[model samples]
Target: MIGGASAYDGTNCKAPGNCWEPKPGYPDKVAGSKYDPKHDPKEINKQSESIKAMEARNAQRVANFKKTGTFVYDVSKIPAAN
Candidate 1:
């Protein structure tokens, strides 16, 4: 059964040569720390722009497919059928 994100126990690193090491959690504890909003507006804007560009490209591809009944294929390399 699946549980919430924090339900599963993380790695145990009690002994030497173990991979796990304690790292500071999000909004890390520090002296005189000030809290800021988690989301970045600049990053969000960039992501939006990327999504719009992708949509435009996809529309263009669809239009091309409609114009040409034959679809593009890489005849040089064929995928293995399992």
Candidate 2:
């Protein structure tokens, strides 16, 4: 007979014919799927590009502020934090 609680992540299949085993404290249905970077390479590249662009913009803003001794800002305009 199959015995013991299964791993919560369901990445492990303990023994043979024990597929119906239950995991304690975590329901089997809500576990996230295993990560596969190969499945979404374009999305990953887009995110990477966006991060690089933001870093470059921030560095430029900091350099400009240091040189001019004044930071540009408008109280009425604020970028929403996504």
Give the best candidate by lDDT. 2
Which tens-of-lDDT digit does each residue in 1-82 have in candidate 2? Answer: 6688754656455766566654566455554534323456787699889999878777666666676677745422333335
User: TM-score for all predictions?
Assistant: 0.41, 0.43
Clashes of each: 0, 0
Compared with the true structure, model 2 gives a TM-score of: 0.43
**Can you list the residue pairs that collide in candidate 1?**
none
**Which ten contiguous residues of candidate 1 have the minimum total lDDT?**
72-81
Query: For residue 42, what is the lDDT in candidate 2?
Result: 82
Per-residue alpha-carbon lDDT of candidate 1 for residues 1-82, written as tens digits (9 for 90 to 100):
6677654356665775565654656444443445444667898799889999878666655555566664434322322324
Point out where model 2 deviates above 4 Å.
1-38, 73-82
**Model 1 shows how many backbone clashes?**
0
Q: List ranges where model 1 is wrong by over 4 Å.
A: 1-33, 38-40, 72-82
